[model samples]
Target chain A: MNNPADLRYATSHEWVRLEGEIATVGISDHAQEELTDVVFVELPAVGRAVDAGDPTAVVESVKAASDIYAPISGEVVEVNPEVEADPSLVNTDPYGKGWIFKLKVKDAAHVSKLMDAAAYAAQIS
Target chain B: MISEIKSSPLEAAHVVLGAKLVPFAGWNMPVQYTSIIDEHTAVRTACGIFDISHMGQFIASGPTAAAWLNGLLTNDIAKLGIGEGQYTLMLNEAGGVIDDLIAYRTGETEFFLVVNASMIDEDFAWMDARKNANVTLRNESAQWAGMAIQGPTAVEVFAKVFPDETLPPRNGIMTTAAGAVVCRTGYTGEDGFEFFSPAAEGIAWWDKFLAAGAKPCGLGARDSLRLEMGYPLNGNDLSPERTPVEAGLGFFCALEKGDFIGRETLARQKTDGPAVKLTALRYLDKGPPPRAHYPVVSADGTVLGELASGVLSPSLMTGIGMAYLPAEFSKIGTPLQIEVRGRLFSAEVVKKPFYKPAPSA
Candidate 1:
């Protein structure tokens, strides 16, 4: 599942890499693998405020659509245009170029409360 | 309330291939083996095999079988010669579809029927209660296992599996040297044959087909392949309250033949014109894949109806779907909107089939 140790994960399969006040969010590799072929990605609009567990984006495979939830409360600062143009990036490079959005964290402490990489791995396993 | 889900005879094989199993119509069936797009492409370009054991099969025989069946089903059964098959529908007294199935004339007095899985019991009960004294109906679903090998290379794969046997002509049925029944027909608009064998020998035959080069496909690919051709899924596209006339399936209803259970209503709708028609729609631009139950709207913001079946076509790389819309909006090139999660995507009513396969070499 290649879940990096530095990133924190939510039970819903999202991962966050906190860089100071701004956090980059994307689905975990394990999540992408489970989704198989990613055909379309609906990114959250920039400047939209979302609470933890709110559905902020959508990822669609051939069979069905899944909502990507906001791991923690934040205001969307940016969304990945690359993923919108080529959704397969989410399946091929979920941690890198496929990152869905950048959020200005409302509470840095809430990010710590989420599962660390080891705990996320254990939870998925 | 918990109910038992039936398992396919090839369940173990699917598990070994790491298939994603999901509950479909009261059966635990494989929805995908690899990815839906990958499997769908394989069937379109080469050969792909699908487990159809969960579907229901029946055998009708007797001196009066053909006559009896014609009175119940919409198609004229007497028109089919021995070894020939025809796609037909069984409807209720009000002309509403009960089930859509393929009827094959296996012998002078015998016919084989392949019906939808969910309607097995209801279909049987309906026919049984009205069966003539000279007709005998038998539900042989549990005794047989079925597989459909479809694609441009399907015939070649069939030859490799049964070297000595020849497949029947299109929509024809013939028995093999090993007592298996092979029907030359498929839902995917491709050259293919459906094979039915004794239940216990299912795994062996599946392996033989795979060894002969048919890629394993599941229900997910099956849905997309059929929808590409604009074929209706019984539960999704055809239903008890909708008649064949409204569904654009009047061609299969043989209204000129004689009186059938649903003939009167169909005849009336055929002459007066159905109020609503099952229409096909395609996306004008890139958007999320359309799905069933998504609301379909008009350019003027009128809520026409919801999609009966929808999918993102792998061949066309666009969203395509079907919905029952008012007659005024069912014409080809009519602009429409598909609402998904409060967002509307631009689309238009296209022709029946969203895709057409190229001529076979």
Candidate 2:
């Protein structure tokens, strides 16, 4: 509930924050709550091209496995090596330490249509 | 994941505490509230309570009820004293298991059976079709709620909550002041009780236990605990097409007893020898965790069997699973291979009760 205002969300529960030409991506609080207890996350290879709405990374919990879809089509500039070393960071602070990758957005205009804190909360409700 | 909402008696309470509700089988139940390891350890070292309300409860009673149950169950129910419970199996005519259950003999003419939630309707029909007027069978699952308080400190917690009367003393049934059917029986291979009460009263009793200081455990820990004990879940290890003969649960079947519903088939299988037996496997190399239906291969990577149940055991620190492998591979220390996520991982067939702690050792 840290006012997800600055972060933009996808219908699949991922969040993207634009920083200059780079966008930091990770799952939102609602997604982390639903996934629960992140055990192991398969990191995206740095410098890989990703398409939106497709599996870019995999996460395995004690219960089941899931895929994290790329919120926007992009080229992966860097992966969070810390998250691969400690996956629980996603469950602790999904917005910060849990960021999956930094993507160079292919279409910056699409970010405007994504939900903010208020709209994302409304969408989940 | 399909996240359609369904409510159990404690649905509101679980939502309030931010439980990760998942669709298990058919009901929406909490998979875990916090971490699976924390809850799993809580149930092993201390105490954890579970809302087993989704399981089915049944009653079959009358002058003929005992006789009917004798024919239906593999165990010798007639041998049980009043207030005693015995593990039993209901089988199809082909000796395939219909469901595995625990029957509590409330009296000579009264009995209570706890069965898998998913098979209640079919099992009830099977029992009813074979039932005679000397006995009566009724599905009481909807009217009752089953809750389990498990682990080493279970008795202490129960004693504090119900100080007025004796709770079941270690696998014994004892009436409690809480007006619940308290049985010291558990599936976790630990000291605990599975308590049953009217459905409406379950909510209050669940709250009462929590207020009295019991941790609410979820399905995640329950699966891990039972798996470690080599207890085959009904749907997984004991399927309708599989019999005690194939599942390595023949110990619960009494072949010498009087004729039962599936006695003939089971007897034939016993005489011929079980072609396959349930085997335990542990991964030798760290890899993707094995899951149900994953194939079990041989030393040279020949397919032997498929996994029946698999889980990441925090206690074992590896992927432990069960499979119905050929008799040759059922021995302890049988090195085998498990295909996890399409990759073969070196695994060994181990013995049951894999990690029995020193107290239960």
RMSD each, Å: 0.9, 3.3
lDDT tens per residue, model 1, B164-220: 888899999999988999999888998999999999999999999999999999999
Badly placed stretches (over 4 Å) of model 2 are A3-7, A17-24, A45-48, A75-78, A102-122, B1-28, B303-305, B357-361
State the lDDT of candidate 1 residue by residue for A23-104, as single tens digits.
9999999999888889999998899999999999999999989999999999999999999999999999999999999999
lDDT of 2 by residue, B1-361 (tens): 7644445766777788777788766678888888787888888888898888888888888988887898899998887778888889999888888989899888879998888877887889988888876787889887877789988887778878788767655556655665679887888888889988888887788887787667888999899889988899987888877889888778889888899988887888889988888898988866555778999999987999799998877677578899998888888898999986566888888878867854742
Q: Please tell me what DockQ candidate 1 reaches.
A: 0.89
Docking class of 2: acceptable
**Poorest 10 consecutive residues by lDDT, candidate 2 chain A:** A1-10
> Fraction of the real A/B interface contacts present in each candidate?
0.82, 0.41
Instruction: Provide per-model DockQ scores.
Output: 0.89, 0.44
TM-score of each model, paired residue for residue: 0.99, 0.89
